[model samples]
Target: MTTLSQSGGRRLIDLVPHIVLIVGVLIFAFPIYVTLIGSTWDSATIGRGNLPLTPGGEALVNYGQAWSESHGARASYTPVRVMLLNSLVMALTIALGKIAISIISAYAVAFFRFPFRMAFFWMIFITLMLPVEVRIIPTYKVVADLGLIDSYAGLTIPLIASATATLLFRQFFLTIPDELVEAAKIDGAGALRFFVDVVLPLSKTNIAALFVILFIYGWNQYLWPLLITNSADMETIVIGITKMIGTGEAANDWNLIMATTVLAMLPPIAVVVLMQRWFVKGLVDSEK
Candidate 1:
């Protein structure tokens, strides 16, 4: 009876946090739910605050109009589609480049001990403390000098190296056993072969987690892209979305705006959901 009571008490303790978390999740998600529902209505109805709990007739019509007019009032270009593609290309390029560079850099740092090793690592770590906003001016100048402004290189090249990814991979690599490295070396495996066959195989989870993080970061980039990209063809999804909201004299089309917002969010949401298993596994492995 005492053991049974103890088990029950333990179960209750575990349940308490989950219950609280679910309530908190609901609180946060309610607004997004409202926005999604609001997207299905006509702008006038949304402006009038007559948004229904359930979506009605206005969803398809507003979505169609939003898709059609996303470029501008003149409707010369489809801004949404262009911006979507730009964001995807930029995000994927950055994610892949960062991962490639970080994996190599991190493996070197984690596995090799050379002169001024700690100093080099510390210098790299220091970059993490400097905000990207602080470096924007110099970055812009460099991009302008290289004629990368208003080009894909301007959007993707500067962000190819990520301090966070390097640090995350370094931590994970440090946790791996030295015996494995020694064994690989004894088997005539060079550094490249060891890294490719041993380290990378073990780092699948970490790589997946990093990919998701960097992808989201690149996708949500607005200020930098806005600063660099002069052409409408070069604008990202986030920048396009902000421009969709009109100024004071102009009437804002809330329905179309909300619909575009919803569509813009779908990719990141899908990415996270699809990779959730790997994300969770990465967290577990990191803990181990």
Candidate 2:
């Protein structure tokens, strides 16, 4: 009996983590499932307050309307398609721009022994301590002065130069053997050529990892986009989704709102899922 009880206790211990994982998955997934089902119903069905547990047959109609029609009772009629495109552009631009700029900054800082290099790096590092909210007013003024508000450059440029990415690349660059640099120079490879061919290839993993992170960060931006883009056509999906759901005092088309929400979330999720392998590899390699 003692032996049997010990074996059973060990089995229970082994099963505990799986049980917790399953419960955690359910806890997170239930709301998404509800959102998915909610999107399939009609506005009347959703607006009634009691949400349905089952999927409705109106999935196609709801999604079609969401993709094409104006959301809420707002006078502006920005389609979800336009919002999706805007978000894609903002996310891609931010990711690529940050990586490009960070790579160059990291290369310069890591490879070159110039005066005030550390000072410049520390200046950037200091900016990371100041969150965007702290500098919002000044940033807006600059963007406004440049006449970039409601434009893609306005949405992306301010957010692209990441100290974090620069630090990551800088660290990774430091790990590169000095022999490679000497070898490249001996082989008559210029700085630009070595950077383009050697350093870039070595940094692919870090790039992919940073892309995933920056893409999501850009995609989920709410405050900046909200303040910058006055035009409905320029609004990103994250901000546009808010315009879909009416204020609590007003009537909201819950079905349409939920559908739009799902659509807004898909691209980031797809990006992370597709690039997960490279993302993981990049993160691991960058740590060295």
Candidate 3:
């Protein structure tokens, strides 16, 4: 009887974890499933409430109307394609910019001997504590002074300096052996050549990982974009979706909004899926 009770107790413990994980997954997935299904229906069907679990036949039409907002005069916001393009540009530019700047900054701090180097690094690190919310006013003023508002530069440039990625790269660089530095020196590889050949290749996994993360960060930016962009053309997908719902409007186009949401989720999902291996390795694998 003791043996039977012990076995049952262990099984319950094991079963509990699995049950918890399954419940968590379902909680996250259910809303996504409902959104996908709702995207296929017409606005009236969704407006009526009690949305059906099954997908409707208006998938193509709904997607088309969402994608091409020029279909009619009733478009409440910028077209999804235009917003998508803006978001893609912002995400890619921010990701690349952050990675480039962070990697170079890390490489310099890790490899070079400069006065006040650690101080500079610490300053950058400290900025992480001063999030965008704290500095948005000054940032906006800077961008406004530079006349970058409503431009791609305004959308991405201010958001690109990433202290977290810089820290990660610095930590990874520190893990690299002194042997590689000597080896590169012996090969008569100048700083530029050594950095191009050695450091860049070794940091690929980290770069890929940060790129995916930074891309999503840029893609989801709302407050900065909202503050900077006054024109419809500069609207991002995140903001565009919000604009579509409007202020207490009873005639909200739920179908197009759902469709837009699904569309908005695709790029981040694709980035994660495509570079999944590198991302995982960058996070977990401990090779210099």
Candidate 4:
């Protein structure tokens, strides 16, 4: 009886984690579920202050209006298609640029001996203590002087070289076996060739995982994009969606606004969900 009771107690302890996880999931998902249901309803229904817990019939209409139609009388109205394209360009550029620069920087720091190497690494690492918000004024001034404001270069370049990504790559590269480097050298591989052939292939999981993270970060950027891009053509979907909501309470189009919000979330969610396996593997392997 004591043995049976102990087994039952162990099972109960295991079950406790699952119960907590289920509750957490429900709490996190409830807002998204409400947003999804609210997106399908009419502005009138939403404006009337009805809580939308069920799907409504205006899904197609709301989506169509949000995507293709313009918000008439709004001076800064941008097409959803244009905003989506801008966001895609910004996100892709930031992700690929950050990964490319970070990997090369990390490879140099990890493998090569040079003066001020640690200094450079520490300099990059120190940036983590200072977020974009803290450096926004200087960053904006540089972009303005470079004639990049309201341009893709302005939106992406200022944010691309990530200290965190550099640190992550450096940590991962240090874990790679020294024997691999010796083998490549004996086989007559130069520095560039060794890196291209040996290191990059081994770093795919890390690259993909970081890409997912950086892409989402770029996509969700609000303050930087808002401050940089004054042109409607360069506005990102995240900013454009907020602009959709009118000033006065009575003037807001909740249905169209919520539809735009849904569109804004899909790309990042899709990237994370699709690359979840690689992301998990990268995190695990990077630690080793």
Best by TM-score: 3
- Per-candidate alpha-carbon RMSD to the true structure: 3.1, 2.1, 1.6, 1.9
lDDT of 4: 0.88
Winner of 1 and 3 under TM-score: 3
* Tens-digit lDDT track of model 2 for 1-288: 999999999999999999999999999999899999999988777767777798899899878988998754423346889999999999999999999999999999999999999999999888889988999999999999999989999999999889999988898999999999999999999989999999999988889999999999999999999999998889899887787654453466777778888998899999999999999999775443
RMSD of 1: 3.1
| C-alpha lDDT (0 to 100) for residue 224 of candidate 3 | 91
Error of 1 at 212 (Å): 1.0
> What residue runs in model 1 are displaced by over 4 Å at the alpha carbon?
1-19, 71-78, 286-288
**Root-mean-square deviation of candidate 3:** 1.6
Predicted structure 1: lDDT: 0.83
Tell me the TM-score of each prediction against the true structure.
Answer: 0.89, 0.93, 0.95, 0.94
lDDT of each: 0.83, 0.88, 0.90, 0.88
Give per-residue CA lDDT, model 4, range 1-288, as digits (tens).
Answer: 999999999999999999999999999999888889998998778778886698999999888877887773223357778899999999999999999999999999999999999999999999999967899999999999999999999999989999999999898889888888899999999999989998898899999899999999999999999999988889999888777764566667777777888888889989999999998998776443
On the 0 to 100 scale, the lDDT of residue 172 in model 4 is 87
Q: Candidate 2 — which residues are off by over 4 angstroms?
A: 1-8, 71-77, 286-288
Q: Which stretch of 10 consecutive residues in model 3 shows the poorest summed lDDT?
A: 69-78
Candidate 2 vs candidate 3: which has greater lDDT? 3
Off by over 4 Å in 4: 72-76, 286-288
TM-score of 1: 0.89
Any runs in candidate 3 off by more than 4 Å, and if so which?
1-4, 71-75
Question: Which predicted model would earn the best lDDT?
Answer: 3
Q: Tens digit of lDDT per residue, candidate 1, span 154-215? A: 99999898888888889888888888878998999999899989888898988898888889
